[model samples]
Target chain A: MMTSPDSTGTVPVTALTGLSAFPLTPLKDGQLDQTAFIGLVQRLVAAGVDSITVLGSTGSYMYLDRAERERVIRLAVQHAAGIPVLAGVGAMRTEHVLAHIDDARAAGAAGVLLAPVGYQRLDDDEVFELFRAATGRSELPVVVYDNPSTTHFTFSNQLYGRIAQLPGIISIKIPGVPADPEKARAHVAAIRAVLPEHVGIGVSGDAFGAAGLIAGCDTWFTAVGGTIPVPMLGITRAVQAGEPAKAQALSEDLQPLWELIGQCGSLRVSAAIAERQGLAAPDCLPLPVQGLKPDQRAQLALMLDRLGLASL
Target chain B: MMTSPDSTGTVPVTALTGLSAFPLTPLKDGQLDQTAFIGLVQRLVAAGVDSITVLGSTGSYMYLDRAERERVIRLAVQHAAGIPVLAGVGAMRTEHVLAHIDDARAAGAAGVLLAPVGYQRLDDDEVFELFRAATGRSELPVVVYDNPSTTHFTFSNQLYGRIAQLPGIISIKIPGVPADPEKARAHVAAIRAVLPEHVGIGVSGDAFGAAGLIAGCDTWFTAVGGTIPVPMLGITRAVQAGEPAKAQALSEDLQPLWELIGQCGSLRVSAAIAERQGLAAPDCLPLPVQGLKPDQRAQLALMLDRLGLASL
Candidate 1:
């Protein structure tokens, strides 16, 4: 639920209070698999996920040229069928990110997600200005993504406090590196205490959804949830329904997949899972974004079957 | 000591058996410090450096736009005169790198240095294909840059074997992360053994230059040497003349500078050092590519004095 753009020209979003999915950008023969991508989004919508995010790390936003990125955002916003579609607007330069934000707003994106990604390592001031520059210009809600796994830059709690003061920031994706149950919950709760009541604090660890949900993560900023929506929903719902055992069991079932995802981070792993599960085309990703190796694919297949989600 | 490009498009040259300077790209009011950049090259040449490398990490190539990058390459090549000017051609896309290669060749660059710097995490095949796409088309000799600190992608010995088989590749810059003298030496020797006899193995640790020289580094690929070249020559000459005491003294003098460089990384530190040393304008760099903090700069100034390099 989006309340439209604010007076300051930023999108004012409804409180994101449930599971959200970030779908992989499927490709065919090095071209985006638009049909498969649309189908994947449809699945998430049918599963009643809160929102669908596009152009995340799994989307291979870095690998594609600017034209391709603009096209993806346009297509995602068009096909999302009124479900709020958040577009990742990260780039190497501040101007580049601003350009993407312009495209996102034009393409009717509900909001934009940003991660501090570039060639140079930024200090606190640089990183802050990066967010401010983008948020200050965009007419969409800004979700500050803190995925140090891919960006290789960590935003301390203190840094996040400073970032929260930016005018257009509607949400912050808390990093979930130490995704253990206790650690993950403690981390989420600590950040939740600091964020404004109106702003959302989402959990990024797909495997640790139960813990995060139990600990009051407003949204599950997730990868697997985007591809296979049912199980992610099950885990979140079980926790929300006050059934800790059910939530833990659903989370436990996702452990095997999480183990694979842990190796090279979520994007690479989620891209493979989506492709194998027929949610995306066979050649759904370009070079440098290869699927899981044969043995790993087999492991994934077996895990999916054991969890009764092979078909989904 | 460099030979011109061969008929086969491979850069040919005399063995690089001495120090090579890699100067930072100076900035003034968000513009290239043309006067300072040309002056930096003149100083390197005047100090009798064996070769010069432009657009390295110290050059902040990643932070600048393509137009800015092309200008730097053109300026460096024009001013380097007879000395070999190796241009960094790393970019997020293969086509972009390919375009830089063409510019490097057209600009009269003696060679091209490359790093695996796309946003995606590269496997062996992706890295190989990245090089092949670049080297397969470039007319200049290729120098493989293996700085995991910036790129976050390390080149293993096995991967280097595959990379070595490429035609235009004539040199490899061994990583200096674990900059311990013995470990660095052992690492360089291992790579050197794998490379063709004519193909040089260079060391990139600016602080550990004499140590690398003593350890059999044919080329001291350095950042500071590109600015204050005389001291680098002194250290290398001492090592070559079998004067370990003299070499050790020089290395010890550089230790303080290296300590500061190690804290944030050479790119940021070198950018500050070059600016403070009056090689570039004060406001050349925009956001993100900042100089060292106050205390670090003080430490650097003291170290430069103790090393008798303060005047430079």
Candidate 2:
């Protein structure tokens, strides 16, 4: 049902399923902390995430320059240790997206993720044409990143169906699913009905990832998992091992972090968690993206400790 | 109430009042069409616009790299001919925004526009910190650009009040006012009540420019005005000369254009108008941002002709 774009052994669409960790490209005084970033990558690889996606929203892709993005892409691939690396190649212009895609491919990325990073509020036609251009230009399998909170462009189911038909679109990273079980299943079903069988449904929004996976999403493109992949992998393995309750229980244990993420966004919360755990440099997020204040970080630390995750 | 940052004789806050036209940085084969951009600046000067703000949403600022943005800023200031060139200095990172401000100031721009450009859904504190950093880093008077339709970060009036207290914030560029005259007045008044007396209220969203002016907004930060300054000037001057009826009438004559703009975004419509009027290269907008289709262009041309705007 799916075809490889090249013989470089790029990660097949089937491999796109399961937990894909999105790491923070932590910064040190406005410069990429390469050692810290590599540590994050090695952590993901050691934890055995299904894929390593850099330059995602959690990765602060748009904040970095092209050279920095290329460095990230290259570093991610270099350290991934045979784990498939996907790069987020989104920019406001299609040309930049294509260039980023080329960078990803050159860096040996298994796939590239594209969000309709917009400043000019794009329409359906413009978005479709962007994917058409990217898929047409590169052989790397593409992942459609639908992040309305960040990109501010909502994709209708019809639009998703249209873009899914593009030659190399291997997955759609949806925002989230409903909290209620039946409703979540219906939501996933609505999207699944439109997508080709081989095209995977990867869910974002860390809080709802377990629900999404239990409802039939193939992957959890997660923010928290990028920093602490164990609990997330527990949920994913539980789901894969046909224990939905176990997966939900694993997810429920991290409810406080999810609540904090709901209060502060997932990016900042994840950064706080990483900094608290000594995984990244202090004050790791890129500016003007301030991480949690001292009090908030303390609260997060306490929550993590209570959840038995402070040592992670 | 306002003190000049220095004797650079930068455009004062008072001068920031009235129509500040936002011109498109039309591209030719993925590069800045410098000549076309200068022509746009010269046209605005000849039409006597109060200020020329380049690299706003219409200028595709986010799509451009640092060198390209610097070029645009330099060219705009060089060609604006004393019309108080204001450059939009918004980027996702505070450092980049500061860098852009430095570039704008070095390029001899009178002021810079700051939008809370976000990828992580920034909070009020983060947005405030960004403005604080920008204003603190440079003496360039800043305009708070609140175009949520593009930036996706809505500024609460309280946030406006907080940011306005910062030194060197000259104006607040609001998206639009309410349609009903009384409601529009009330809306503007509500914002005015929060802003410092030195900070002006500039309205964007071209269709509502006339009403915004009549409702006591100081400037119409417009897209269509950049392409066809005559009628926009007519409306602005009428408002300035205390002829609200005339301003409303002139705006009414362009209703069809506004309707089309509502259908196709103002950026694409403005690009089409520039191309139609032989002002810019064919298909002038940046890649992925397609210009109007042939049929849409034809309809636009007919409307321009019908409104006596064809030869401007």
lDDT tens string, model 1, A164-203? 8787787888765354767766777778677777788887
Q: How much lDDT does candidate 2 score?
A: 0.88
Provide TM-scores for the models: 0.88, 0.94
Worst 10 residues of 1 chain A by lDDT: A4-13
lDDT of 1 by residue, B1-312 (tens): 345453322243445557778888887776777888899888888888888888987777776667888888778767776777788888876667887888777777778899998566778887898898877885567888988877889888878878888877878887652457677678777877778776787778677677777777777888767777887888888888899679979778777777877786777666666777777766455554456778877877777777677687
Model 2's CAPRI class?
medium
Interface RMSD of each: 2.4, 1.0
Instruction: Report the CAPRI category for model 1.
Output: acceptable
Candidate 2 local lDDT, B231-285, one digit each (tens): 9999999999999999999899889999999998999999999988888999898
- On lDDT, the candidate that comes out on top is 2
Angstrom error of the Cα, residue A215, model 1: value is 1.6
Tell me how far the alpha carbon of residue B20 in candidate 1 is from the true structure, in angstroms, after superposition: 2.7
